[model samples]
Target: MNKEVKELDLIIIGAGPAGLTAAIYASRAKLNMLLIEDAIVGGQVRSSYTIENYPGFKKVEGGTLADLMQEQAQELGAEIDEFDMVERVQFSDSEKIVETSSYIYKPKAVIISTGAVPRKLPIANEEKYAGKGVHYCAVCDGAMYEGKTVGVVGGGNSALEEALFLSRFAEKVILVRRYDYFKGEKATLDEVLNHPKIEVMYNWDLVDVNGAEFMEKAKIKNTLTGEEKEIVMDAVFGYIGTEPKTKLFKDYINLNPQGYILTDENMRTNIKGVYGAGDVREKAFRQITTAVADGTISALDAEKYIVESKRVK
Candidate 1:
């Protein structure tokens, strides 16, 4: 089958905070931009229930914030294409090629903001109970388990922090770690451990999730003794880690060992006219604010690249 090809000034791979912000800047700059997303326009922010950290609003729902961003970007003349998954990226000397499931887009500049995917547990029935009583984002599904007992998997900063946040609503939170030691910061570790509603279980790994319709219990195994035990719980939240979604760019761009795209302060990758933003890029922290900042930087940098390339011609 023949593929439809369209030329664009700029192409953004995500519709999240970073990508939307980038689109806003690019549109204001009068650049013809295309924003593509595999799911909804809001990226991870849509999954969150409440956002208290984002500036401007005292407190707001994540879906609402995402909707506003989408509207603003659209009003600025940025074209949004949701549910379109990018299949591959081919970088040439002058133009970057983005092939999605529906069409092929050629852009003078490309901003990668694919973001990260949630990590999952490798236990039996864990996948079965997903969205039933198992969740990954505390900001997204934390409220559903309110006043109920839930289990959090992992001991890293994300796990510890989410457990602390869930404590506000949940009656009890069980924090289970595969290792005896924690990888999170000392201060966060101290706070999670000191919380009375949070229970810390060392050297325990989730082996199974048992329930009739929703999750009711979790089967855990002791790493050292090989003993198995079941913990009654209302829900399970896994925060092991995040993996970057950069498989399409692996052969075309320089990426870190963990598959995160490598970009400079200007959000430019090693290849010219190609930039990265959001959680896909290497950074100290991955948050809505940070991703938005990345989007702004990438759009400006892309504009500069476009001007310079025209000058050389």
Candidate 2:
């Protein structure tokens, strides 16, 4: 039997800050809409232990902020469907079809806010030791290394934050950075530097990992002097960077060399009646505030397009 087919004014593809923000606006506009998420509603924001930069809040947990966003959207009458994976999409100027595991949606406008995924470490046996010793989310795997030693790779906000979070569980946290200076916020960098449990390795790169069953040693080399050293750790957490999660829409959308969707200032992709927002789009910066802004612009643009198209019809 065929799946149920429902039509609406718009369909938001992600429930992160971007998609949630769009849903809030769309609901206020009284547009028939649905927000779908394959994973948790909060997206990457849930991973953060503490967030202080977001406006209006002095300090808040990432999960709490996400919950507030989700609450606001729902209160605004936005219909959200969680854990429904979109299987396929067909976009055009007149109509767009989105197919998921449970239903098939035919919406007049579609917003893509799938966001990005963590970049993996490019070291030997990294895949073999993925779950055993190599992990991307310290929040999820840090508890597993209780009273043990773990190494964190990267020099950005995520690396610094994860190191602090891991320090609570690991007896010692080795933060490995290839650059001489950290690139994250000054406050976060300062905290990591001052934390006694965390050891910051400047101008050093993790070249390899060695072990039989689980990871035993991480081989790091000094970038300036070419000196190498091995640190014995139970696990390695990588936060080098992230790549766009555009695999589902890559063939249909115009993407840059780095695989981020290319969009105009209005958040309109090359395809009409379709839009890209948040970390999934090609932008200089990726932040919760920026993603919210992107979602607002796209939803408004999409609403206008739908109204104009109705007149034309």
Candidate 3:
């Protein structure tokens, strides 16, 4: 049997907040749109237990927020296809083609909002103890170490943020960093540094993770003196760094040195009919609020492009 092919006005590559928000805006603009997601629609936000930062709600479940966003987008006539992974993209001057595991879709424009993935430490036994003890996202695994000791690796914004977040649930939190100085924002650094529950271990690197069934201890090394020490912990959270999910567009879009998509202030890429948003784009902040803002901006920019193109013809 031949596969079905559909042509749409806009094809949003992810179903996360950014993608869904874009769909909401594009659908409201009366654009025939399609949203494709490889996994569940929530993206990383679904793993969070409570989101107190998002405006309006003092405290709301992450999954609940995701469900609401999905429902809102679908209610606006956005066609959502779950479990469809975008394998490749072919962009021309006039249109863009997205090839997925199940089918091929041609759209007048495309919005890339694939977001990012966690970065892992090069320490030994890190992968071996993935589910056993070591975790990359505190929001995803913080409940497992409730009232227990946990170690956070890295000194960036995310590391300090995770340390602060973990302190709410964990009994004790140790933050380990290779550099003596932290690269996170001053406010975040000060908050974590002064927090009663968090202890800072400067100039130290995680050398190994030791455990049988789960993580029991972490071997840390002093970067300055080459001294090694072991600390007992119930779990380890790695907040080192994040890598953008832009590999699928490697052949089509221009990327920066860090692999984020290169886009202008309007979220327009070098390609005329293609745009990018969220953490995948070269931006100052990678917060959920920023991603939502980017989605709105990109949708408007895409609408302008579509209207101008139609007028010229």
Clashes of each: 0, 0, 0
lDDT of 1 by residue, 142-194 (tens): 88987999999987767887898899899999998999999887977998889
TM-score of each: 0.83, 0.96, 0.90
Better of 1 and 2 by TM-score: 2
Please give, for residues 212-304, the per-residue lDDT of candidate 3 as tens digits.
788899999999999998999878888887899999898889999999999998899989989999888998888778888889999999988
TM-score of candidate 3 versus the correct structure, residues matched by position: 0.90
Q: Write the candidate numbers in order of decreasing TM-score.
A: 2, 3, 1
Q: Where does model 3 exceed 4 Å of error?
A: 57-61, 181-196
lDDT tens digits, residue span 130-240, model 2: 999999998778899999999999988889989999999999999999988988999999889899999988999999888889999999999999999888988999998
Error at 56, model 3, angstroms? 3.5
Candidate 1 residue 111 C-alpha distance from true site, Å: 0.3
Q: Cα deviation in Å at residue 107, candidate 2?
A: 0.8
Instruction: Return whichever of 1 and 3 wins on TM-score.
Output: 3
Clashing pairs in model 3, backbone N/Cα/C closer than 3 A: none
The most accurate candidate by lDDT is: 2
